[model samples]
Target: CLSSQHTEGNVGTKSEEKLIELIPLIISCSREKHIWKHIYVFLTPGLKWHSAGVVRPTLTVLPPSKEEDKQSSATVVCLATGGFPSNWKLGWTVGGTSTSSGVSTSLEVLGTDGRYSWSSTLSLSADQWRKAGSVSCEASLSGQSPVTQTLDPDHCSE
Candidate 1:
């Protein structure tokens, strides 16, 4: 996880505003002789105001209860919060086989701080889930191991 954070430095009073003409930053305030102020500037090159953090994903199998031993469809929805400046890939895995047609992914929505919150859903037939196979939602990012969560059809229906 690559995160950029800046902390406020101790500034003493009796200081005057200093600006390099070559730089593009604009300071609107002047420091008094007896006052001190600390400022923290946060910015990311590819991502804005990013915090280095890993996302812990939550899984919801909708139509929560379903019929058993029958062919039906259910939704495997995953919601992840608090991931930074990275793209995520979500897929549907049935009995450890990845299904491309059964998966549909969504774009990342901008968060309050300009970070991203993402959601992806996979709809599969009931038989695939009921076969005692594993249905998983995996959130993939660069340089980090993907976070995967599994749902059990039998246990989910009960």
Candidate 2:
């Protein structure tokens, strides 16, 4: 026989708490029964179960450098930081359309605060950039709404 129970209680302070699940298993052999207990704990702050340990990434879109402005091609960088789990994906969109050409993404780097940071660079021709409309960078995680930052080239300072 197997049974499970869930319990919640405060941990450390009033702003922090944890959810604990206890599962008890019973085994029978030769008319004898033994019981074993398993415990699982989830640390939650403020007793909020939504997103729990998951932290949404902050996104930033950087305009092209001065040197790039004089060149035939321009490069823009998208930075995503302060996210947990290290599984976030960074993507780029040009004029509301997904694009992969001349796009490079870096591996997720672990930070001192136990979060993750990553970046993606998009390179476009000078002519394409002027007509790119709106460039957007998106940081997405499974089952969560993506965080996006958009930049309009026409409004950027040279």
Candidate 3:
């Protein structure tokens, strides 16, 4: 069993005396049919608790990537040209928030073979784009974290 004890000043320590507890199971191997079944084992342990305070989780925001930091300002525009067959929703995030207004989404275009494509655009003046925290073209699939491409001021206007 795995166990730990914590003290006010120290992080929890694992119990070394009984570090392992084993559970056994009967198993059969196709390649070793003559052996019939072999014994399989696993270890599980009980955890101990202590009074030492736990560290609080700190919120961490990743800095915009180096490339993105440059794409700011100038006539800002966002585009999603393809990948519609996957039902990817395209949108923007500015100053760490999702934005729907000040944007225009296009109608889906269907290809001859049942595939589709779509585009969305978010525009801003050069000055506003420079000072804004971030400009992101986010593509999200249902029930999944969005994959975003951040446009940095350096990549923009220039």
lDDT value, residue 158 of candidate 2: 73
Per candidate, the number of residue pairs that clash is: 1, 0, 17
Error of 3 at 71 (Å): 18
Q: Which segments of model 2 are wrong by more than 4 Å?
A: 1-52
Which model is ahead, 1 or 2, in terms of lDDT?
Answer: 2
Greater TM-score among 2 and 3 belongs to 2
State each model's CA lDDT, in order. 0.53, 0.74, 0.48
Q: lDDT of candidate 3?
A: 0.48
Per residue, candidate 3 scores C-alpha lDDT tens digits across 23-122 of 2333334544544432222222444421111111111112333354456423334444434233566677876888787777667653332234565666
Candidate topping TM-score: 2
lDDT of 1 by residue, 1-158 (tens): 11123223422222133311111122324445433322222342343332234354434434324442344766677776656543666666767877776666778765555355777777666666568467777777766677777776656645
Model 3 residue 61 CA deviation in Å: 22
Ranking by lDDT: 2, 1, 3
Cα error of candidate 3 at position 22, Å: 54
lDDT (C-alpha) at residue 36 in model 3: 43
| lDDT for model 1 | 0.53
TM-score for all models, in order of appearance = 0.57, 0.68, 0.45
lDDT of 2 by residue, 84-113 (tens): 657889999998999999999999875545
Q: What is the lDDT, from 0 to 100, of the residue 125 in candidate 2? A: 89
